[model samples]
Target: MKIVDKIGFDEILLQLAEEASELSQAALKLRRARMGINPTPITCEKANLHLLEEIADVTLCFGILNLSDTEFDYIEHTAKKKYRRWKKRLGIDKE
Candidate 1:
């Protein structure tokens, strides 16, 4: 099915972006703490690992690269078809 025909792509992308940004901020905080004079590498590594897990959870929820090959192929085909139609309507060529 087309992206529009399925759930809203923009909303899904926005949610994924927000989740990624949150994970990035958490990682930065862990990095800064690890660079201190008395750094705790083990603690920092643990926090980073948790952050990675959270990222993976978000990715799975967003269905980003987690779908089966057949499902992904269908999504790609639908997206391309919609994109071509949109471009043509807007007078854009596939150059």
Candidate 2:
């Protein structure tokens, strides 16, 4: 096994997780606005901009993995599947 794999490079994943969490939090704030859950609702546009930046940060960390195209394809496929499932559960997706 490669030294990097042996080491597990966990720190990168930690950062990715942090960024992803921030993105999730931002999305939740937007959802609050849309659902009228907040008394003083957040601006959807500002929340979205923050979410976009967090998404970019997460993607940038992904490049540190140096994964092959096939690996990326697998990740993309699985992520899309999960997204679809979540969307369906939220009733945001008709089909």
Candidate 3:
């Protein structure tokens, strides 16, 4: 039986969203740790580990969602566009 057959597609989508949110939160925590903003003292090493773990979870969700190479290419293209816009906003690039 296919993986999607065992687990409904809707569930996979939900899981992907949850994992992505978790990854975002992990990134925020890492930033907080680096800036020493949060009262809850956490080691930078632990924060980095947490972020890495969340990234792995999100990557696994992408696999379960059966992302294709074409989808990846589109994502890369969009990311490059966004990166260019970001650099321009920061005055790092003229274009």
Candidate 4:
């Protein structure tokens, strides 16, 4: 049986949520470290490494969720649209 089948979908979703939260925290920590805003200062390299680790964890969670091709395509489309909007907002849209 597949690992997801053994773990159940709900548990996997919960794990995804937890990993996403950790990713968010890692991003915040990296930002704070970069800005020198932390009371316990961390090296930028260490902060970046921590952020990378969290990103990997969240990515692994996403992989385990087994999204269908249609769902994956939709996400890619939406992400591209958002990227365009973001570039326009920043006055960096080349097209």
Model 2 alpha-carbon miss at residue 2, Å: 17
Residue 25, model 2, lDDT? 89
Q: List the residue pairs that clash in candidate 4.
A: none
Which parts of model 4 have CA positions greater than 4 angstroms off? none
lDDT of 1: 0.72
Tens digit of per-residue lDDT, candidate 2, span 4-52: 4665678778877988898898788777766775643467787778778
Enumerate residue pairs that collide in model 2: none
Give one digit per residue, the lDDT tens place, for model 1 in 8-95. 6676677678788878877776776678765655577777776787688576655653468898789789999999999988889664
Please give the ranking of all candidate structures by TM-score, highest first, separated by commas.
Answer: 4, 3, 2, 1
On TM-score, the leading prediction is 4
Give the alpha carbon lDDT tens digit for every residue of 57-77 in model 4.
989888888999999999999
lDDT computed for candidate 4:
0.89
TM-score of 2: 0.66
Residue 1 in model 2: lDDT: 62
Clashes of each: 0, 0, 0, 0
Model 3 deviation from native, Cα RMSD in Å: 1.6
